[model samples]
Every structure is written in C-alpha cells, then in structure tokens.
Target: MDRQTLDMEGARRGEISSASLQMGEDTIAVQCIATMSVESMEFSPWETATNKRAQSLYASFFVINLFFGLMALAWGGLFPGNGSSFIALVIGGVLTLLGFVLGIRAAMMARRMKRRQPYYRLVIGASDGRRIPLVDNNRDVLMRIRDVVRHKMDSGDREIRGDFDLDLDLVNLNLPTEAQKAQTLSRGPDIVPKSRQRETEVEAATAETESEVLFDQDAEIIRDAS
Candidate 1:
C-alpha cells in the first residue's frame, strides 16, 4: 500500500503522517471563486411573483372602479332630481373610495417588495473542496468581503479557514471607521520633495551656528572694553 493512501491499514495502525495533516490544513484556506447578484425576484421568486400578480389585480380593480365611478357621476348629473340618480351617485362615490384604497394597498406592497431585494452574494471556495455561499442585501458587506479576499490573495494565502458568517450586522462591524479611512487616504506622497526638505534643514542648522558664534564674539568684545 502507498504511504499517501488512507486505507483501513493506516487507520488501524494509526500511521497517519504530518504531511497528510498539512494537506488537510492547506485545504481549509478560503478563496473567492465567483459572485452573484440576487435581485428581489431571485431572492424570493415565488413571493415576488405572487406580489406582482396581486399588484396587477389591485391596479386593474382600481382602474375599473374609477371608470364606473366617473360614469355614475356623469349619469347622476344628467338625470338630476331622480331617485335612481341619487343611488348612482352614492354607488359611484363608494367605488371611487374603494379604488383609492386598493391603489394605496398596491403601492405599499410594491414598496415592500423593493425593500426586500437582496444586493449580492459571494461564492467562497474553501481548500477542503467545499464552496460556501455568503449573501447579503447591503453593498457595504460585499465591498468588505472583496477587500478581505484581495488582502488574503495579496499576502499569498490562497485559502481561508474558519467559518465566515454571511450576516450583514455581524460583518458590518468589521468595516473601517471614517477617521481610519481618511488616514488611509492621506498616506499618498506629499507635494514637497525630499531634497528640498533636506536643504531647508541644512540652512536652518547653519544659521543657528552662525548666530551662536556672533554672540560669543560680542561677549569677547565686551570683556576687552571692560
């Protein structure tokens, strides 16, 4: 049997090598393989579809009711002082109110559907041959994940270990503060040249030495005059 083989003999004799353990450790590194953007429809396909259908029904009902209400009002105006005209006016008013209510309900439902839409998902590839999916509706979370993966890759660590939670609240805490971000941005090269800075320092030192020597000469002249 080959040393690389993890057969029953190796298990029975307890002869597992450190190399195998290292290989297992290597498999646990995390890598970002792919990403997917989850829209509202994709996040809850059935729910979104149902909501859309309901919205359409409600909108149609509103339009129909509005048409009937306008027609009834016109009819009532044409046949003034009749009992049927009074009834038509009342019925039209009720329908118009009902249509308004339905329209409002539909608008509310549409707003909710838009709010529940997911922003994106990350496909994390682990060294252990497992692909884990991390999803969130916040763009900030996606940006943080991208930064983490880029840092890991730049450091030559092709794999990431440990469990990475996809929760937005949890991941959001890891984001850099405004001050930290500002500091990072300020790390760019300054406008002044290094050579100019060195020259200024040298000139200042020479001026200070000359001032000191002049002071000593004045003290000597005072002693001679005394």
Candidate 2:
C-alpha cells in the first residue's frame, strides 16, 4: 500500500510517535508499528486450501473402507460353496477398522500441526550444527540478537557469528583494556627503508668487486699475449 494509506491507518491507530516523515507537499507518509506487534498475521486463502484437501482425503478414507467392507460381505454371500470367502470377509473387516483409526489420527495431527506455528528453537546445550535453544521463552534469542547488534556497533567487526562457533571469540572482548591497546601499539615494523638500502648497497659492492677481479684476470691474459 502507498505511504498515505499507511499514514492514515497509523493516524487512526494514534501511533505517529512525533516522528516526522518527510514527503513532498502532495505526498503523505505512513508510520507503521514493528511487524512483531501485529496481533494476527494475514495470509492468502490459497495457502490454506491445501489443508482442506488433506481433510477431504482423510474424510474419504472411512467411505472407501466402508465400500470395501460391503464388497467383502457381498462376496461371502455369493460363494456359499467356498469357506475362503468367509476368511476374506474377516480380513477385510480387520483392515477397514485399522484404516479408519489411522485416518482419524492423521486428520487430528494435521490440524494440530497447522494450528501450531512452527518455531525454530536453538538449544544451547544440545547444539549439534542445528538449533541453539535460548531461554525457554525466546528471551535468550532476543538477548543474543541485542548483544550481537551491540557488539557490531561497538567493535565495527563484520565477521559472521557462525565463524565463532568453535570459539567464543566475540564474547571475550569485554572491554579492550587500556593495557592491551598499549601492548598492541608497542609492536613496531621490522624492515625500515634505511636498513633495506644498506643491504642493497652491500650486495652491489660485492658484485663490483667480483667484476674487478675478472677484469684483472683478463688484463693478465692480454699482457701474456702481447
């Protein structure tokens, strides 16, 4: 929806917290409450149509079993000469009973699962690369989120929380003590340009000396030839 509609709705609800929303003179602004505060969530009816299908399928199970039971009864009546027909009737009755019971249970479970919104639980104790359940009432989850947000704002570190799975490296930074900061500053770079220049000069001098020695040997050969 457009901002004007949002603002009008917010105004009706009286939630405009003195917050100025800048829009053109012709435009309107809408202030909305945090999404979590919305009491009942809205969803498309199409999303729930699948549930109706499951319910219908569950309801049909009984009808199907009843029809099969009637068929078994008819077969037993038609074959007075065969004792096996009577045995088949008993087996069908047993299966029909079992199907009805299981079908009812499945219907109840589906409705229960649908009504209960699936929640992700993070169990801190039994954490095995999946859930890490914080305190029972989602308090731990909120607290962790708050702490993580605070940690990022203070430290300016962009590392993902998952990186610290094996080690609680983020939690240890209680307050980079003054001494620790000083110690970090104390370490200096080893290779100054002056030291590197001196080493290069020494190497050049050694190469020059070798060149002169070779020149002297050449001069001796020339002297003997002459």
Candidate 3:
C-alpha cells in the first residue's frame, strides 16, 4: 500500500534495471560506501591475445636468442686467439641486438594491452558487520548506481538497502571495442559524391542563364512596342 512496498514489488520482477546494485527500503546503507576507486588489472602476457600461440612463440624467440647470444659472446671473450673468435663476436652482437629489440616489443605490447582493460569497484563498510563489495566494468552504469544510492543517503534515508551481483568476473571493462568503433564510423554524416555535386552545380548554372535570356527578350519586345 506504501511506496516501499511498491518499489519492492517492482524489484522482484526485475523491472528496476540498472547496474547490478539495488537500493530501497530493504537494501544496504548507502552511507556504507566508504571508499570508491577506479582501478586496472592487467591480463597475463600469455592470456592477453586472441592468438595465444603467436604470443608464446614471440616470447620463446626472445629467450632463445638472448641466451645463445650471451653464450657466443662469452666464448669469443674467452678464446680471443682462436680463428673463429671474430666470427663469434660478430654473430653474437647481431643476435643480441635482435633479442633486445624483440624483448622491447613484447614489453610495449603488454603495456598497450593493459591500457585497454579497466575495473570499477565499490566498497561498502557496514556499521554492524563485514564490508560489502560491488564491482562492475561499466563506468557509466556503476556511476549511475552510485549517484542514486548517494542521493538516497544524502536525503536522510536510514532504511537503505543495496543488492549486488557478485558474478562479475566474466564481465569485461568499458572500452571502445573494434566493432563499436566501426559502428560509430558508420553513423557519420553522409557525404555526397563529387560527381553528384558537380551535376547539381551545372543545373543551377543553366537555370540562371535561361532566366537572364528571358529577361533580355522581354526588354527588346517592350522597346519595339515603344
């Protein structure tokens, strides 16, 4: 019969849709949100790519080249008088440079992949018990939920309730996915082809010329009548 009961009924049917957080008379206290932070978690170097085998192969190349190059250099240093010492030095230097370049490439790729991933977390501390946690990948969705709960808290709502969906491990963070980027590009303003634009200009020019000729003919007939 009251507002609380109505909200509860709506929640039961999943009509109240937003992030996973639910706030109402039976939910956790919004004031319990003691800390809020945006964080990032890195994907493992091996697990960061669609092509796992390629990633593994590159890593192997880095290790193998570096190891062999160092060994060859050591051999050259220990046997300077040997006939092959100069050859060993040359091969070692080239291989070492190649290995170093590969290692740098791997490091840069890892950093880039990490930048594409992000996490949004909310921590709530209960006055009477353990802390509660809510995590989501969508920054906008999470912020909206937080604002709603905070509004209720600021308005002196003591009987606050909060619900969270803890199964968020499979959810990915908000980023411009390749598909989304392509979709956005597709929505850009339509551009007229150059040929079509040229045709329109020519039609306007012809219309203007015809109008000028008609005006000249009317003037000549008026003069002859005078």
Predicted model with the maximum lDDT? 3
lDDT of 3 by residue, 1-226 (tens): 0011111111221112222333323344345545444343322323433534454566778888999999889989999999999899889888888888877876655554444334455544555564444445555655654565565556754333333332332222232345587888989988899999999999999999999999999999999999
Q: What is the model-wide C-alpha lDDT for candidate 1?
A: 0.55
Q: Put the candidates in TM-score order, highest first.
A: 1, 3, 2
- Give every collision pair in model 3: 27-160, 27-161, 27-162, 28-161, 28-162
Q: Which stretches of candidate 1 lie over 4 Å from their true place?
A: 1-47, 111-120, 125-132, 137-161, 168-226
TM-score, candidate 3, is 0.33
Candidate 1, residues 1-226: lDDT per residue as tens digits?
0111111110111111211111212332323333333222234322445678888898899899988988898889899888899989998899889889988987876666555333454444545455544445555654565565555556644333222333322332232345577887888766789999999999999999999999999999999999
Q: Which of the predicted structures, 1 or 2, would earn the higher TM-score when compared with the native? A: 1
Total colliding residue pairs, candidate 3: 5
User: lDDT values of the candidates?
Assistant: 0.55, 0.44, 0.55
Error of 3 at 81 (Å): 1.0
Instruction: Quantify how close model 3 is to the true structure by its C-alpha RMSD in Å.
Output: 24.2
Comparing 1 with 3 on lDDT, the higher-scoring candidate is 3
